[model samples]
Target chain A: MSKYTLREAMAIHASRQIRNEDKVIVGTGMPLVAAIIAKNCHAKDAVMLMEAGPFDSNPLALPSCVADPRGFVGAPWVADPVQMMGMILQQGRIDLGFLGGAQVDKYGNLNSTCLGTYKNANVRLPGSGGASDIGAMAKRNLIIIAHEARRLVEKVDYLTTPGWMLHPYENGKRVKDRLVHRKELGLWGGPEAVVTTMGIMKFEEETKVMYVSEYYADLGVTLEMIKENTGFAIDTSKADQVIPPTEDELYILRNVADPENIFI
Target chain B: MVSESKNSTKKTKIKTLQEAISQIPDGATILFGGWTVTRKPMAAVFEIIRQGKKDLHLVSNPGGPESDLLIGAGLVGISETNFIGHEVLGIPYCFRRAFEKGGLEKTGYLHDDWTVQTGALRILAGAMGIPFIPTKSLKGTEIIDPEHDLLADLRGKSKKLPNKKVEFIQDPFWDEGELLLIPAIKPDYCIIHVPMVGEEGTVRIHGGLFMDFYGALAAKKTIVTTEQITSEDYLKKQPDLNSIPAEFISDIVEVPYGGHPTAVQGMYDLDFEFFNRMVDSTKKEDTYVQWLQEWIKDLPDHDAYLEKLGVKKIFSLRADPGLGYNPRLKRKS
Candidate 1:
């Protein structure tokens, strides 16, 4: 196992979420690093798609931005956003999606809009770019964000992106025996994992509530720390130590994927 | 299909940037081409603001400085966009200020996955001379729910928005899947910046075509500003590079460094320092006004704007043709 920065470990963990030949929809920056690492390591043929409208892009270098020219370097088909999102993603062709959010809730709801109410905002973050669509439409979503109490809240200030929904009965049961997927609300599956700097979170099968599934042993994290840092109650029964990234995985990320450490 | 094989003769006339933009009047709806922080026709945007055009409805897949500057200047009456934020720099301060101050009106839904694609489909429908097109994007989302008045109703009622936001119905063919019918959007004028344009008005867009071709075709008229203007014969040799044929375009203007602060592929990198400075100043209304005075009002035209940018700074932003990014920005990590 390779010793790595928290960010690098997060990237590795996020990469592990992807599977071989998965039709992955990706956001920018860290997701880009993770996807590239996945392609280099195990999921070699994972079809990388960007919301900016490129498919099967074999970029010469890590794209500086979502709209970066590197995306078109060896891309097979360059399409419009309509073709990318409407015809492909909204058509339910995507297998996995990688996203980032400012704040996420126990129900996996995401907030990238204003911090306060819509009419009055203390701090207005950038609203959803393509997160709402990816979250609402992709088969499964994997969220990567810095772990902090402020970010992992009990309930997001605004539900910019829907996750596991609040069906009335689920709230009463304290466990979602009647847990509804986003598809029940006529959307796609909600988030499956929340990869953080400290650990990886997965939704409980029955309740659809998030809990720490894997803790970073190298970070010296404890179940108490995860609980204290989280705004809501968390399930630690299924939690276990996550295996660190292999040296080869670390080398590919550092030397090939991101030599500048721009995202790593 | 017939339009593609016509005479192949250039029909649109070339004009100065001023003369070309002078055609746009107040209350006109304009669609812009380019995505966030890349290939935006900032030169045309600055000119529109400098000309003091008002109440103009603007449309883009999702624009950056071009939309934010116009909204901040209080020139745009309504803007239909997917998302408007400085990509890595966070939300644009001016855009937020415009909405917070009630200076600009906004329509359309959030997220590029729907908004840009829907906007492009609207453009495509217009290009095909259709009234509306059916789409599968907005079935589950609230934007098409009709209950969401902001997105569904639009600003009161006007000829500008003649059709409903979306009409949900069962797919008649299969009688199973649900679909939404969206109305077409034909802007009065469309403005875009390209890497190069032949003398005959064939636009060669380097990098990604973020619905620029659709935006150009979907509008009543299109004005192109390019980094370089080459001969028709030069473009004829390589027909694949010609994304926008001359027939759809109305006017072509050669404006070097037309997409400043943003970027033009193979020409320059994004002026991060300049955008950062603008963001810092535009954090508050007072300083934002000051920034406008220095960057917009004080400058006579795009030429003066370039002059204000200085030769050294412009040169520093220039990217090597081979590398696609400025070599000056080397970070040893």
Candidate 2:
């Protein structure tokens, strides 16, 4: 297998999180790319929901946005945004939600609201569209973000989406604990994985603090590089080198999922 | 109860696009109907720019060309947006530029459930004459956080409006539960482009009804532009197809290819090349002004705008009847 772009690797890694029966609520860009790839390959029966109110849409081409005209093609049920989010999502019917953020903390908390202050931001990002809802309610959520020191911060400026609120330190080392559940906060679900350009990261089941799971070895991305780019201390003790994308996966993604190579 | 007038007494007010849009007073709160580049009321938005309307407050859930053009023209004062982007084409360059430059004032909410859905719920509440609607999505997020002053700052800048931007309350019945309540929004006017509008004011929207259905109801008045304005009898044949009732609409204009640059599902495809050009032109300040001069200022009206787009480009975007999208359009992988 040859080397792949980080975007392609991220999409491929993100697709691995989808299961055959998972009802996925997808956002735009790479999440759509990853979902299409998963649908065409492993998670063929996965129910996909678009925020613009379509269920089980089978478009010939990838939809550019949630409400892209293509999303309406051969859709099983077309609903209003309220019905999709308020009725379906808020009801906790969605199983998986794929989201992205401008910044993510060690606890997997996301910040897409603003850079400095909400009112006066040094760099005002496009705020969470449905990320908060998805992050708060999807039974399991996957986040896709580029690897950078500032992006993977120790603490986010604002908690746009709840990650793990309980981060207790013992002897300056994180302890294994689940202090607050989404259910406790009147929200459901939480971050499951963080797929980045370099590798995949997951939270310690008990601690809910993110740790490197698999580093992409084929791309020559080292654990040291990952640590250097991360704002917080990341545990790579049990991390393994990820196998490169198989030829079959690359062929399917390039030819079928992202024929436009929009994300790749 | 006074018996509602049932006769053809319901007037189908017809106005030129300019005249219809001129009714939107300066600084009036407005809402636009469309998602992304599809079905955006480009012709009417262009008219607003040409008329030099100023200090307008736009409430678009997930906006596109309409809001972008308004901000670019400096006509908008405050904008409540969830996602102001061109989708695959990328974020709205002018909007981002204006926003970052402080040339535009803005507030955003979560799109997944809070932003667009909340907007829809707000509109539904407004249509039903409700004070506010309870939502569970914005809770546990910064949107409901009192410390977040993104919206509060803008509220201070604007004139005294009737409704509070957002409010939080502990659920009276539930022991440990709370909810976010967004006040109902009734826009002074809402302009939307549709595939067809009946001569009697019925609107037939192709593809997903999206927020257009609610936006029409949530506004005090609705102005509709369509690819074709068929006879009232034609629309009456298929009552199920009618999305917006005649009574809610104030005026209807027949404007072919009015959703150009954007799309009119089953009629044409999004002009990707045009979007690319807009993105490129808006990358720099001087070039954006030049692009605007060529497209908006120079072109007198919708006809002129279409004429400037040229027959070849327009024909290329035309969707095949069976496919509902341009068959000739190709995306490079």
Candidate 3:
């Protein structure tokens, strides 16, 4: 069995969460890596779809973004992106969406939108593509971001995609009503999980608050570190039972990712 | 469709990119051709942003904040691009804030095989005079169902009612339908920026055409912006260099060095400092407008805009133009 690098292990851990029955929509970057790992390991039947309309296809390499045709080079099928947006996403075909964010808040809301305050502040990030739709429409959403205090903040400066608890209406309401009425949507019931380089986090089903669910093995980060970063109490039970990548998982990752030593 | 004669009589005139863009109406869907910052029509794009045309839908390859000028300006209401947010360079603040405020409308597409397959096949469909193309693509996936509505609009009269029961197709041997069909897309207008064009509107692109030429051909209308304009004789001299002939061109505006701030292949490297400033400026609509007014509005025309670049800077740019610059013979020392 090949040895896995820390990045691979982290990726695998995130990947294992996807269920075979789930329809997965993934964006670029580490999220793509994690989804691939999930497909190669636990979620074989998971329908892999990209925002660009490639389904269950293995790209030659991870695309820089969703539009780079390189991502769908090895896919089983490809479709027009405009069709994907106008028809598929609007119709609500995607089940689970996996995205990466620059910042995530206590409620699991994300801010990939900007670095500073809204309206005349600092750095501007890429605005939402379909993320707003995914955040609003997808049955389930998962976000993967690197673990850092700066990233896991109390409140995101910008809400690129507002999550569930932040919804305006309670229980079942029209999507538009819930989006429009809410003065501020907190991460009440939005993201199912947030995978990080340091550990995995999930919202408490009852409280709709973020809590640490898992931690990587052989890593020096502590539960307190997670708490310090997140500013919330974490469930140790889930964190301790975190699954480690198997030997076979390591083999696939090393062969697939094969990061250069210098870059690593 | 508008008749060709109506467009044929339209005079081809010299204008800066901004002035050319000012002519476009509101709610116009524009197809921006370029791969990221490589060959974008920056001047036209900047002018569009400055004009603050609302409900603009842009179709192009996603290139982060460098490409977010429209989004930042609150001009973009819809996009059929692949990605946004700066992955490497830095995100544009205006776009980010607008997103956070839920003020922008956006649609993302996948890149890679899907983008190429769809774009290529759709263009082929248009070129072939077909309404749609059938491919094995998206077969067996959730995208196959009309309920998934990957192509069929499920809202208003165009709404596709979901028939959830998967039906079996009866054949001589097999009794089941095997695949799903994805519809083709023909854009309303395609905007292209090239290295050079002749007076007759013959375009010459230096690098791989990618899907730009196909998109232009497939679109109903084609608008071209170029970095340099030469005589019609020069175009005839190099017939092989022309990617799209004058017949294909619907409207041509000679905008010399049109792609400013954004990189133009064989012309200039991306003005990162300007991009960063734009990113910072995008945070507020007023500021963004002010920035646009300062850079784009004040420039009277393309010639004046080029003059703003200054001869010394242009000479420096000419000396080491990245991809397509050809050195002219030096005078005897």
Off by over 4 Å in 1: A1-3, A166-180, A185-189, B1-12, B100-114, B139-148, B151-156, B327-333
Report i-RMS for every model.
5.7, 5.8, 12.7
The CA lDDT of each predicted structure is: 0.77, 0.77, 0.57
Candidate maximizing TM-score: 2
- Residue-level lDDT tens digits of model 2 in B154-265: 4555442433566766788866576667777778888889988877788988777777777788888889988888877798999998888888888898888888788778
Q: Candidate 1 on B279-330: residue-level lDDT in tens?
A: 7887777887888889988988888899999999999888878756675654
All candidates: CA RMSD in angstroms?
Answer: 4.7, 4.8, 11.8
If you assessed candidate 3 against the hidden native complex, which CAPRI class would it receive?
incorrect
Window of ten residues with lowest summed lDDT in model 3 chain B: B107-116
Which pairs of residues collide in candidate 2? Answer: A128-B110, A129-B110, A129-B111, A129-B112, A130-B111, A130-B112, A259-B333, A260-B333
Candidate 3 lDDT score at position B160: 20
Ranking by TM-score: 2, 1, 3
DockQ of all predictions against the true structure, Cα-based: 0.34, 0.38, 0.06
lDDT score, candidate 2, position A201: 95
Local error of candidate 1 at residue B119 (angstroms): 3.5
Clashes of each: 0, 8, 36
lDDT for each residue of candidate 1 in A144-185, tens digit (9 for 90 to 100) = 998889999987876666678643122112233344565554
